[model samples]
Target: MGARRGFQEAVLAIVKKIPPGKTLSYKDVAGRAGNPHAYRAVGSILNRYDAKKWHIPCHRVVRSDLPAPRPGLYFVYAVLCGNGAIYIGQTGNLQKRWMQHRNGTASDYTRRYGARQLFHYEQHGSREEAVQREKWLKTGFGRKWLKREWKAGRTRQAGGTPGGYRWGSKRKLHLLKKEGAL
Candidate 1:
């Protein structure tokens, strides 16, 4: 237990040093933590990390095959619109793009639907990579995966309408399993 805690602490320290908007793969993190073969262990530690108790930026550690390339500023973002629609997009500057959507200057669709909240985002290392990821997220399978993975709660409206889209059905779970993301 002591050794496990020490390893977790070391991993967290390395993660904390990652600059904002940049990412390190699990393998890279493990190597930095002084155990080149402990990539999966590094991922386990990060997954179990207590964000409230520790200020480590665990989000910076991602899978090596993540769509992002190395060395640049880009992001793939997802927003839940007011009318129960999800919008996926990519940008070099996330804050600026989000503000544009909020301020009604992003696009006809977003302006008409009204962007409600930022539901998910992933940092990329270049504009090209961001665009590729954005394209993938717009696909049918990717959309389904996002819905199943990031379902959020919504308030009950008048007329007994169902709030929030529920993607926890068995079929969706099966699909996630097939994709090996579960």
Candidate 2:
């Protein structure tokens, strides 16, 4: 009974720690609660979260990799978008990186892109592999890469207004007239 109470308290604390545009998977929550191997149990706990869509972002949790669990993946995707998590990048120490973003020490890219956490993550081997995968995701798809691959919903617009002192066609004509070239 005492142990069960402790778990409940842990769950509530973790949920509270989740920021406005961030998330944590069942696996991540469970692991942080000192269970490391309780993804299924964590999911069960989340499934019964009475607060549901209000207090907890139950939809952000997702199954890792392809051939996902269909409805579950779609649900997670929706939550990610709602939470402003427009991109998905991986790091060797997934948990550590998650902490960095949550604590406001996020990467330049994440800062510029307005991305946030929205679910848990599954381990995908070594850190090198994860870095390589991130690089590939950023490059292989280009614009599609940012959208389909990285899940970047927001974009930095390409060009801004020209400065008041740029050499344009009119400027070139004026210069030629001054030099007697036209």
Question: On residues 1-182, what C-alpha lDDT tens digit does candidate 1 reach at each position?
Answer: 98778877888889889765344557678888888789889867766766447766565454443233344878887877768898888877665566566545787877777665666778877788889989999999989878877755331111111111123235433432243222
Instruction: Show pairs that collide, candidate 2.
Output: 23-117, 25-119, 25-120, 86-151, 141-145
Q: Which ranges of candidate 1 are over 4 A from the true structure?
A: 1-71, 152-182
- Give the number of the best model, judged by TM-score: 1
TM-score of 2: 0.42
The sequence of per-residue lDDT tens digits that candidate 2 reaches over residues 1-182 is: 89766876676678667654444556567878878677676656655665534465443343322223222121111112223544456644434454444334556645444332333333444556656555554464632545553344443221111112122445533432343222
lDDT of model number 2: 0.45
Weakest 10 consecutive residues of candidate 1 by summed lDDT: 156-165
lDDT of model 1 at residue 175?
Answer: 37
For candidate 1, the per-residue lDDT at 141 reads 93
